[model samples]
Target: MSDENKSKTFLGFDFSTQRLKAVVIDENYEVCHEADVEFDVDLPEFRTSGGVVRGEKGEVTAPTLLWVKALDMVMDRLIVAGVDFSTIEALSGAAQQHGSVWWAKGSKERLKNLSSEDFLHTQLASTFMADSPVWMDSSTSADCRAIEEAVGGPEELAKVTGSRAYERFTGAQIRKMHRTRPRSYSATERISLVSSFACSLFLGEYAPIDLADGSGMNLLDIHSMQWCEEALKACGDEKLSKKLGVPVPSATVVGNISSYFVKRYGFKPDCKVVAFTGDNCSALAGLRLRSGWVGLSLGTSDTLLLGLQEARAPPAGHILVGPTSEAPYMALLCFANGSLTRQSHRDRLVGASWEAFNELLQATVRGNMGYMGIYYDTAEIVPRAVSGRWLYDASGRALDKCAPQFEARALLEGQAIARRVHAEDMGFKLDSSSRVIATGGASVNKELLQIFADVFHTPVYVQDKHANAALLGAAIRAAEVWSVHTNTKLTGSEPSISPVATPYPDSEAIYTPMLERYRQYVDTIPKLQ
Candidate 1:
């Protein structure tokens, strides 16, 4: 709480609705304490004409209550760790991007009651328990299509917001919320991005939305770095303040930790609350991927991001927007496709134990481009509006037909081609001449890494996913705030391993014809409209 203790330590939350990762790092940036709090994301389903759905189909949404539980668990873990709640300097967070949480008009005052035993018992508990639509669930594609028609299409949307109206984007979700839940939308005080909501609540102020999360919103004007007045007015809200709107630097000192949080954490009264950011941007920071360093994330989804010195609107279908951090900008191309696709096919054939699949995969010699004949879809269902059309074989079987292993190889080949196309479309080349670093779960897989290296014809550096980089990035933001506010010589989160890489010992074959076909397929898909 005093000037002497300001440099002690810091804390952060990687706030996901499903699971919360709490991290404690001292002034040296080493992990002193950390815990992952898991909770159910009980999003009730809405009835659809076909089935229960998420956005338009009577699909259910994640409630704000789950978020509250995640918070409670995170807080409880931090407390149990015997962390000097006061020495925690300040906190910020990384959360699911574009998900919205509503609050009553004056909920700002309500957050200061951190010590109240009635915390979960309040109405706030119930709200978070339901309807927190994550940044997936493409049930709202219809809504996106409608909006695209009204707003002149995806290119128009991109020109203004640096993104298209994808079903998973926050903009489509917002429009869906307004039409289906007018009362809730009207009663909503500030439609908080999950990142902003957490930072605002803990800091005891109306926290500003940082560039990363704000960039996910189709409503935010990427060129100007503010909410688009025309879009907001057209969306039927003239008063912009009610919605979380503002683009602050990633490390901006939004405010100090509220007395309630300080007392609860036992942090000094002067602990500063840093600006919050999104998981994607936080991951970039955690990776320590600076300029000229391209980051490839192969998690449940795949994200290829390049940090830049200034903001640039994504050309046509490319995604160019604010870095999830305080950097000037970052260009990202994310595909909903990833290991999930591989798992689905494996689930069907290999059953619950993936060890068998791994063994089979390991024993299977890499034939000269075993997947060269297959054509996988990028993002699976975008452009063509199709899903799971496995159309390929490995052992020189059928012409237009398929084999069992077809799906598995297709998923990989498709995503590889998708990555290659995305690079070229975004004005970046995928040749061996360019620099690239791969992160995420898939990066650890030797085969996947080799495939990517051969496809891009570039060496792929594997990053250590040891600690959740996003959580560490959140700590970086928190540490920065603590330093500037209290003159604390706090440490920032950084990667332990260097990103330099070496090639696999296997033959790095190139399938020129397959690469050509994949590029053609991606180019033929209709633009968003």
Candidate 2:
């Protein structure tokens, strides 16, 4: 692309659990340059194992300064890659869903005056709650139950908020903080989800949480797209609504790039900043999924996402507001054990080598000779939520032993089966014409994807650069929002979505019994209250 075309460039950012990635694309949606800053590797001073600080009580958090530091580092790296920031016409971002960032009183003033001479973290180190609670935190079970009971029951809460009170959602987290740290809760002037916090950094002001991301908070009424009074009261703060500003549409332009970026990185002073949304919503946009297509994301938490024309809140899973500013919704099923559980198996049985793990997995037959198991590093979120490793026989009876090969195959098959069962429960049907698109870190594993195909009994599709879909999705959102800003039609044709994994002809014949066994035997598995 030439300098003239550079004026049409759009930049997108993804503040994921393990990394902060940036993707720059031209109006044609062709990649111009990309860069990333890994938390563990690049910001080692924070001492986070998985980009979060974990506690014995199921607490999980990250230093807010670490995220700020990553932004500075990533932008520097992008500049080094020859990205001309001034030419970037618009910017948007995606963040790990459900994480909350607490901004200290007067932080907006601090942000507005950021010095061009210093890095972002150095200036804004004390402007936020020292630690930001993340989606991995499960310490708020008590609060979850309280909120559910307060709203009559779990079913009622689901009807109102599109999901039952989940431990990972922001409402429970806020309630816990309100009870334990009253001073901090009172001192907090504004609370931003991870998405809006990143947006605020660029906008130099507090950004309203986008509706799509806010739906995950358990406070928004899905039907009205506003905070539910009962839900807010249950969170222990009658005034919390003011702190969590009104949500804007995902495509709304929040503001221009902050003057700090204009001076430090050469961004155009008038460059637009679109509302940032949850990473999952961004993934839906990146995939450009059509009706009859479902997406299985293999990230920190494995998610099965299906687009719906009308909203319906199911007892299990979630119905999130769509990425678009219109009526469509996205049905989502999230599993706590995704790449981490798979990595644990790989380390124990295959010396942490994907190649060796793939070899062992392929060596095993369909049912693993009657050995089946549920492998969870932590509690899961499908069917009935539970934790721990469970082994069973072909008749669905408990077993004391299983071969490592069986365990390996069971891990892959178990996840596939869980997603399939939950998707069906949410009214997703897999037929002859249905297609599955796989993304995230594990999508590159053809061996694992074959399991997905066989279990879902459908062909799995992938884009050319599927792994970075979240970042790419953010970029696309930025471009789309910019088009709305300028009232101009976007220039590029949509990218081709193609199949990368297909099931064998006998897939259903082989896995039909296994699926039935899973449905019958899962009831026998232990669960956490």
Candidate 3:
């Protein structure tokens, strides 16, 4: 690569639940600069707890202008960090999936005529119709049921929209808005997912939702990669389709940076804005996962991601169009009880020391000597269960308690097994050739990763930089879109990954029966309920 090519940087932004993060990468994918703005800390006037406001009955939201302020703050921080915005050739971003932003009437005109003299929040203070109902919100059960009823049932809804009517999904959220807040719905001019809303801020107009992110809404037809007419009517009226602009391919260059950004932030007038996508899809691109490979992100909430040659709308989990045009489809399975559950158990049973926790885990034998457990510090998504812990002895008799070491091992093994079972149920196959790429906070725990390897009967690998996968993915998308648009070939080695753990020789034999037993427990729980 020439010096000029090396100097050209691509920027990726992540509008996550808690913060707005940005990463800049050179042509070779080396991270050059990074910055973030935490909504609660940096913009405390909004009085958000964990970046959202909670209300009665599982209502969670963030003020729409909070994000606008975050954008301004993050941009200023990037400049203060000595980042040259003009050198950035292109940019792309990802946001928390399923959060919807309603643009009030005439907001597009407001976006187009933004003044460089003022901060974005001040200029667009009244642009939004209401606080955004985020992915964490669970106040839409009635809306979900209505939507499911409108389109047959849950199975048929999944067949058409790549997901059942999830309460947090955009379709259900939109229905809630239309039915409960009819005036806001009537005054709404456009509906943008968190991803496209971020893109619109850059493009100076409403940006189309990308196919990959659009799939999360329970509104897009996964097979055709377009909005489903039936699903649209289920969400709102005839104008609902227009509120959501045409969905575009994830890598499509939506437009150039808005003049406000060009003037205020020194961004080049020609800097391309690639279509933004959901954070999960961005991580898939960032990890460079191939077919048959699974990406496990072990953060506050664990997520399992894999690529699919053909789309399958499973009875659970979700299916999204792949971030890049080359890949066909992708699956995302979220487990709500992840690191927090692990931390709680470790604190209670092992004195809050990870080293002690690891020692206990390593000392205990696999399958906990026929003991099995399922722990849910909070509600679980994969199984859709309530909070509690269930433990059983080898003979399938309920156990009131067990040894601390057995408890630790059971916790790790159970989480791993649950991931594999749910993933396979989604049609993800496993074999000698299959690989599991682990990322996020827990991936650093070699002992935990070994449990993952052993339970899945596959090798587990970790990248040099796993924490920034989503931000890196956005940067990668920017570079890819730029390469195609300018007809330039990128010359660089792919990001490197190193194997962390390989399956034990007897892993399949040990876990196969355990998997069946685990399924039996899961199947019995609903009956007990």
Candidate 4:
């Protein structure tokens, strides 16, 4: 290989819930190297578990500077791992959705002049409001209600913004901050979603929020792909639109890597920076999901995503502007208690071993004698179900509890059913060729994969890398945007990694009857007040 050809690489970052991770990929889309900085374990001074501070009334936050510190630590770790920064031709990233970062006045000036000698957090202390409400936060019910009413209720709001008012969304979070902390709101110079915030760190200026992630904010008019004036007014920010800056396409080349990176890490002076996007949208780009396939992510929160040729405002779930420019769209449904809920059941009933949990799940018969369950250790995003686990008999009668064997099967079945039903509501169709491509920490479990296959009556597939797809997608996007920026040969648009999953013959027969019962079960559960 020629030196010039081999010298080029791309960098992708996923500023996920608990960690900030960097992945370096070669021209061929192979993951060449990876490194991560864990928030709680590595930066204990922030005192966060899973990268969030929990408090009364369902308040959830993370120190804004903690993210900055993670960026520094992750980069230093990458340099220590012997990554050649000079080879990185371009970079992009993904962030956990809906978390907002408030920049103090003159923070951009501070960013533009970062010195190699000083740490990022050291120079940028007090640059943010510090609370930065995240996706797990549910303290914005009042804001949500007000926004819904302002926009003519939930359905109308959904039609306008692609979602009803969501507590974790940026619109509600911004309204809460604006109302409760007028001083901070007034002092804030600009607002960036976590994705744009990370991008700004690299651009040395505030990056505009990408449409893919901005759609989650409940502030964008999904149809027009512009910020909604009424939605801004509804959020109590008449001047908020200016604070938000203009939205940009997800794959747009934002700018060159900031001089800070060049001076600090010996990066190319002209290394390009692509716009960052929300994690889910990045995963969609990473998976290269076309029609007839749906991606199921089983992480801290379970999310089901499908690519859409056209946009629709479902009363439930979300429709993000697709990662690509043009007319593509994405449909998403999120469940708050994903792996954690399953892990809790595993710990309580199966000794906290995934193998043991699978054993019990395998031992139990299909449908667990007609028992169905909804497990929400915390509040759920879809259906907005009440907190606590709800179990039901075959006939849809509520039960106080079920046996351990039943519990294991029920949890898996309930989650799978929810994904299937919700995806259908969003206009996803299943066929002989349709596949459920599973990814996340839990996707590796054979037993769980089998349940996904059986419940959806579709084959379930997992990637060989088993790495974070969102991060990988960022790397892919960086490559795409780099070609445009450099005016070089364009890379292929499809995802390099393909998933492989098998289907059992009896899956359809096993799950078909249970599907009907699930509909009844959901209706019977009382809504949390």
Residue 396 miss distance in model 4 (angstroms): 3.7
Candidate 3 per-residue lDDT over residues 162-213, each given as its tens digit: 8888878999999899888999999999999999999999999999999999
Q: For model 1, where is the 10-residue window of minimal lDDT?
A: 43-52
What tens-digit string does per-residue lDDT give for candidate 4 at 401-471? 88889988999988888878777777778998888878777777778787788778788777666457898
Q: Please write out the lDDT profile of model 1 over residues 1-529, one tens digit for every residue.
A: 5666454677888875346788888777777888875553322222221111245542435556555655666677777877767566667788866676677665655665545443432535533312566665565677676666666777787777777776666667777767777887777777777888778767766688886678787777777777776556545556754576567767677777776665555566767778787777777777777555667777655677777766555653334454444456777776655655666666775785566655555544443345533232233433333343434344434345444454445556566766776666677754445556776556667666666765666677755445366777788667766677667454444555544444444434444456566665555445432
The clash numbers for all candidates, in the given order, read 26, 0, 0, 0
lDDT of each: 0.63, 0.87, 0.87, 0.86
TM-score of each: 0.84, 0.97, 0.92, 0.95
Candidate 2 TM-score to native: 0.97
Q: How many backbone clashes does candidate 3 have?
A: 0
Better of 1 and 2 by TM-score: 2
lDDT of candidate model 4 versus the reference = 0.86
Off by over 4 Å in 2: 1-7, 325-327
Worst 10 residues of 3 by lDDT: 520-529
Superposed Cα deviation of residue 321, candidate 4 (Å): 0.6
